[model samples]
Target chain A: MSETPIAAPDPPPGLSELFLAFASMSLAGFGGVLPWARRAVVEQRKWLTAEQFNEAFSFSQLLPGPNIVNFSVIFGSRLRGPAGAAVALAGLLGPPLVIVTIFAMLYTRYGDIPWLQGVLSGLAAAAAGLIIATTAKMAKPLFEKALATRSLDAAPLVALAVFFAIGILRWPLPYVLAVAAPVSIALAWFRR
Target chain B: MKGDGDILLTLAGHFALLSLFAIGGANAAVPEMHRVAVELRHWMTDRQFADLFAIAQVSPGPNVIIVTLIGYQAAGLAGALVATLAMCGPTCVFAFYMGRTWERFREARWRNAIQSGLVPISIGLIAASALILALAADRNWVAGAVTFATAAFGYWTRLNPLWMFTAAGLIGLAGYI
Candidate 1:
């Protein structure tokens, strides 16, 4: 796995750029923001390679709290330390907070209208689709790796167990993780 | 009724605790949040909570901002501020420190295993999130069709999804769903 390191072609983005980029993505992110985050960081800005983006995002998910919020903080910290983390977090949060509040105010006033309800219902369904798409995109790389190796790995099996426990049985997260996390990690450790 | 300050303090405390437990992100904590806000504290009715959930999902930014909406419902603007900070603050700091450590040990063997091991679990949880959202949002067959079509389009194409969202909303506005 060792390869000679090469310098990045472009310099890392500055703090302000980080802020603006996060802010723009946050606003543009309807339904879910992770896909937008991946798009901006990996495809558009080239801040991180696709693999790096997946690792960072996976780390964020492993940690407590919201995955994207943690992702923003971690990414900012990686590039520019604490202040960068602060700015990215602020950027990710500030604009949407204001806009959502405005929507909240409006909701209280016209919440009962059929048209508004209808629009929201449609949007919600589409939002679900967006997440499904995101899940598929995330899974593709793992499946590809499994196929290339043609080795039986714990990944797909563990993933199925998790989906069944949480999605179908609706188990509380902590209990399911108590079993799945350890078993998965052990399987990975031995295999590695 | 509890005093305003008491309510704010309570919201802050509860969300702060929830923040640490929200593994796999905010959607993972939806059931807990529902129990706390609607059943325990009685801040809002079930209908209001469901409406706010819809609003949060439809808005921009992280879906976790549902905390902001819940806070606004219970208190006001200040409530929104308090709840959001409470939910994000500790986790942000934790991520800050953890990110540094993770980078420092990027080449470590165990770290790589941990990283690879966690990916599938994260994917599974996200799939669950998608399934739950589909169940909740797709009340009618038209809406379900929209969900299916949107997923297929999003998966196969690289187009900006905002267009689909706009079209879906318009369909709703037109009384189709």
Candidate 2:
């Protein structure tokens, strides 16, 4: 979504560093990768600055895939070229892929077991908590910036309102989106 | 009766259509996934679907990997492979190939307008999905409390998420097998 500023390309980070950085982030990823990803790429490794991260993130958001997976490809490509992108993709996905594959296998074998099913129920609730928590943590900066600009404006507020009305209130989602989406965007245009 | 292959084909058609509508991510299409899994195919019971989702939730990678696991159970190895590739392949190709070209459209008035419009749509979908997940997965007061408390804690506090998971683990220990 950003217009490119004219400048020479930044030098690529080394392969080893890319691998190590992704590994660090992956291991630390608790509720989700966003927190660890923020710590690793922006705070610790200095692979990309905050401005660059946001630009890549916008593109990631625009893409029709998981944002974190897209971030792996975009950030890795920027930091290490095609090979770096490949490495980042593999590193980021490798653990989960392997683990899921194994779990899928075991699940196919043992999933009908009643005890296993009971355990998964509790775990699933926990997963919901995890997802909500992670989204909350990521939302802080957006919330802070909105308050700082003294713009308790409609856009972000509407996004949250739309979310609450649909999520908590159980409004039909398509109707909620149809009504709220344009209004939220218009709020942004006005703020600009 | 339709051959097993035909059932797989039917599931594939469902996923393919769902794939196109997945604007936000793998996570975005989940409510539809639940609809199909529960209402359409009858491949699983509701509790089973909720459990599959939970396992997917705790795992790394994309949230949709559970689709594969569910598919495998319903149809076998081919089902797993078909569901995995079908769920992810279209979106990945769209991103990897057309991503840069998309950025060029950023300057267009309607393009900007579309994004502005899309933001709320996506948010709505996400919230709906989260709520569906909560309803389907949360079976008890303990589970409900964990979800609410965790969400509030995550939103308002700076607690390490790992610690939260640890707390959940303790809760799980009390109730889970």
Candidate 3:
């Protein structure tokens, strides 16, 4: 949608600005950085529009490893080559490593306390809910797109097959994916 | 017991492979991580694995931090460093090259097809991860209720998730859940 012919108002960000932006987002990201990253990149900095953000994020998701980390690298690389990618990655991961280490130390020392254990259990339950919600949010758009496009009937089928294999049957991931991914891709290619 | 170096090497090798397979993001690999860490290797109990995942979620930065914490549990600071690098390093290089190609082929029909096919699979994997996590975390009716309630709120509202976590934590601190 943002593939506009008009010129952008601002120039691209410098390496320092990119680093600081990622660092701030990392600190602010409590549950997941995807939302925070969206705000910082699309709204605050105007580095990418909403459409561009979605494109980059979707592409990042398609690659292996952490989606946001991959997004950081690709976005930074796009902006300033390898150096930008390095700086942005450092900003994203550096602070949290230190903070999490401190938390690890504290948990190790006092983790056996009954009340603390209760708290951790509660947090785990909530985290489960959060993931479900994230899945729902992600699915809504895809389903809508599928219906509108008059294709993607196989998409939901593939999704259900994967869910059954991994979630219910407890099959190994690589094997199920090895079979499922190719079939899904070929289906899409033929349908398209 | 394995030596410290052996443990670190195992962690490095396992996470490197996991990184490549984490197509839907780090959360997609949660079940495998749980299987390896708790069931296969016995690095820690199921409870500890759940707790570390929760801690990573509550803390800032990417969800990938869970790998770092798991590595630390298995070994030490050195383990954390090695695991984090192994998990992220190859992926970074892959993304660097793939992203460049993707931009070049922004309008390629094949790229569109691949993306469409993969999106649903990623969604399915994430749902599986959620199911496993719920099974691990919900030890009682109250905890299960908390999971249901949080899912409702998260889906219906735009409230920051930290608030929900805080409410649940307060419930726990009160010895309720």
Each prediction's DockQ against the real complex: 0.58, 0.40, 0.70
List, residue by residue over A81-178, the lDDT tens digit for candidate 2.
57776787667766665677678788767877766655666576766765666455444555677788896645567657766775566554345555
lDDT of 3: 0.86
Superposed Cα deviation of residue B63, candidate 1 (Å): 3.5
Which lDDT tens digits does candidate 2 get at residues B28-117? 566667777876678887777777777666666556567777777678777876776666556555656554466566577666665665
Q: Pick the candidate with the highest TM-score.
A: 3
Off by over 4 Å in 1: A1-18, A30-62, A78-81, A140-153, B1-10, B27-54
Model 3 Cα lDDT, one tens digit per residue, A1-192: 234321133566788998999999999998779999999988998888888888888889889899999999999887888998999999999999989888887878888899999899989889999999988997888677779988747787788889889888888777888898889888888873
Error of 3 at A175 (Å): 2.0
Interface RMSD of each: 2.9, 4.0, 1.9
Please list the residue runs of candidate 3 whose C-alpha ends up more than 4 Å from where it truly belongs after superposition: A1-12, A140-152
Per-model TM-score versus the true fold: 0.80, 0.75, 0.92
lDDT comparison, 1 vs 2, better candidate: 1
> What shift in Å separates residue B70 of candidate 3 from its native position after superposition?
1.0
Q: Candidate 3 - CAPRI tier?
A: medium
